[model samples]
Target chain A: MALLNKDGSRLDGRGVTDLRPLKITAGVLNRAAGSCLIEWGRNKVLAAVYGPHEVFPKHLTNPRRALINARYIMAPFSSQEEHGRSGPNRRSIEISKVARHVFENVVFTERFPKTMIDVHMEVLQSDGGTRVSAITAASVALADAGIPMRDLVCGVSVGRVDGKLVVDLDKYEDNLGESDVPVVISPRTKELLLFQLDGLLSKKEVSEGLDMIFEAANVIREKQVQALADKFKDVDSGDLQ
Target chain B: MILEEIKEDYIKELLKQKKRIDGRALDAYREIKITKDFIQNAEGSAIAEVGGTKVLAGVKFDIMTPFADRPDEGVVMFGSEFSPIAHPDFNAGPPDENSIELARVVDRGIRSAESIDVKSLFLEEGKVLGVFVDLYILDHSGNLIDTAGLAAMSALKNTKIPKVEDGKIIRNEFTGKLKLVREVAVTTFEKIDGVIIADANSEEEVASEGRMSLSTSSDGFVCSAQKSGKAGFSKQELMDLIDLSSEKSKELLRHI
Candidate 1:
């Protein structure tokens, strides 16, 4: 089946540059110091922040800066047919490492020396593009926790479907698509935090995908800020719950 | 683990007056939330939350050689991880006793109840499908066993077996949902100052003397039961606890 029709419209009835519907909610959990829920199309992700507290195991702690421990987990029932394993599988472990790297650049980790800032991203439901969404949610969660940051991070994936470059490929498109480029950037400084590419792509296609993702990141950054604002709106009005 | 004397005494005193630290009745459970299909990569997955406690269960199926003893039946293996991020007390290492106990309890319940129809999973005499249920403890408020059990059962119920042809599994082609023979639910009660409380939080769990987990099937039969902690339960107390568990299981099974 053609992923995109002759008129440049994709299978999900979106234009080549169109992104999926996005929803972001902050401070959804009571246990975590800060939390955010992000729903990008069929993907549902929750990000929780704990610490800036003492780092356990002691030896892993850094002397000059705090550490960012980021974990990304996909729930067993989040997919269509197979149940995911619960622990840090190879994929999750790698995502955690990369996500931690992304946050270290945005978060002011040096302020809390020898401590750790733990960010947990749980994918409650997924339909592709979870890794990027997880980063988006995690950044909001850190902000929700009132952590100082140089800039908020936002991410999106752009890919090629049926020889047509598209933004925010869904589950169906991700499977059949030829190339996917995921990018995470600091909206304020426009500094790249994460950049990864998979599948085959030409130089021109890579540039086009990167341009789309960079633009999409700005839009997502706005939503992230708004979500945090909504959560603290009551506090701003002097009505503390 | 060191229990704060003041906190322990506070819980004990509250139970005496038929009150809980969290303002729940002795038999009342915390809020229970179950979300299914949480992972897109797994065949079946669910997240079960009991108050602040959260457990994620994912079911994955793989084709493998059946055990020599049970060649005609499929296999179900249960694994659990108590991640350090879940709680401060949980350290990162190999599976500990608590995790092992939790996995065994959850495994026994599903196995004894025959929740999944393993016979139908038999693809051939030597080759059968293996169902792997992995439970991830994300947040640990208390009562992880019950939450993990609930999550596992819900995930299994949501599982869809993929199509297999000539010993090769088709990822995109699903034959149908896994055949479930019965629905199972687990209810845990902690004995605090001789009073039984359902769904104990971390504070209440520390003060409790004994803990009992009862797994009940929809057919109104107690499939599995496990008791732990330093204290013991009387015969009368056990019977009462089982009744309480049976009633609570009905409420939990509704989520499935």
Candidate 2:
């Protein structure tokens, strides 16, 4: 298959379980309490954390717990094919749900009673696994905002394509793949925050994919910590603001 | 942009000193801020901020059959939208003439300059073209034409085409720049105190008799010009405005 090279490998020259090169930027938003931009392969997203402040649109307010509102928007011209309309589509809605689930695990909602925290993630580009990348990046952004959290949440996506297992599928691979499993894990407690899959996978393959994802998530979690420490190192707390 | 009567009066008072509400000269535009390669999914994308006005433009190049009439050249289509989220008065649904005019100004600016090599868009003779320009307005403060043009040109300037080899496409993470032959300039005119002022805001637009827009290049070539309102300008007035626009066009090019 053209998807595989002469050596029976993916075209990008990676082992089926390996990830593409990763680049990240923290504290990208000037106005947000916390923000980050993560580029995983070609999938790009900007995530911003807005509160621990007042909650607007009164009725949706939670009296005892802080509300978490997350919106994921794909720009109108993000794809080669015309998207026709801009704003939330079905895919975006699903991503939003998955993102909220991931953050809810790490964020300590009880600390801020009756308040709300808003997380907005904008997908500037999509290669594949945008939801997993957004969840991972937004967790770091929330921490960057200095919001109280239990443990860092790290998300990774794994998939089986063309009779082989792969992690962090790029756009082309994702488009032609048979199955994808995205999982968000809390590294410290080993808890599941978000779990989702598209396409079909046998029970054995699903379990294997889950194990691979959690292992990857642990490694990614450390990187998120290092990214923050590197930024805040030798700087005063006021500089963080 | 809702303003109290006093605020409107305050704006007029500032205009007496040729000042703007945002502390700029009447003829001066607000600061221009640009972000290129801002969108990852889009082939070419940029966001340009002109003071409070913000526009995001993305260019997506697709391989498709060439038009019957323009078999050798690539097709260029400009899509513009002013959302209600940007300004309170802008309504949703099909665009109005005002929005259409904004798209045309940007279209003319890019087309007249031959910014995109139309021939580059062709894959086979009379088959498969490679470029499309999509422009969107995210925020509207004032000066939509200039802001839109800035966004479109910058978006085009920043765009890169994906390489196709052996009928297999490889999506590269980085982008290459577009081919721009020359830069075009756009200037909006408002008649204030029987004199034409450049780059009017919504407030001045409401109070003025009529407005005209002039777009030109560095070499004093007119690319596009449009007039609005029932009031007409004298021949001499047109010449003076053209002279004013010519100088202002060069200045506008600097911001791009």
Worst window of 10 by summed lDDT in candidate 1 chain A: A195-204
lDDT of 2 by residue, A135-176 (tens): 778888999999988887777888877877788888777767
Chain B global fold similarity (TM-score) for predicted model 2 against the true chain B: 0.86
Instruction: Tell me the number of clashing residue pairs for each predicted model.
Output: 22, 4
Which parts of model 1 have CA positions greater than 4 angstroms off? A1-241, B1-5
Question: Residue B46 lDDT in model 1?
Answer: 97
RMSD, candidate 1, Å: 21.3
User: Which candidate achieves the best lDDT against the true structure?
Assistant: 1
Instruction: Evaluate residue B28 in candidate 1 and report its C-alpha lDDT on the 0 to 100 scale.
Output: 83
lDDT, candidate 2, at B140: 81
Task: Report the lDDT of model 1 for residue A212.
Answer: 81
Residues B1-256 of candidate 1: C-alpha lDDT, one tens digit per residue: 4654459988888888999888988888889899999997899999999999999999999999997657899999999999998987899998865787678778878887778899999998799999999999999999999899999989998899989998988886799999889888888888787788899998888888667777877776566665555344454565666577778989988876
DockQ values of all predictions: 0.01, 0.01
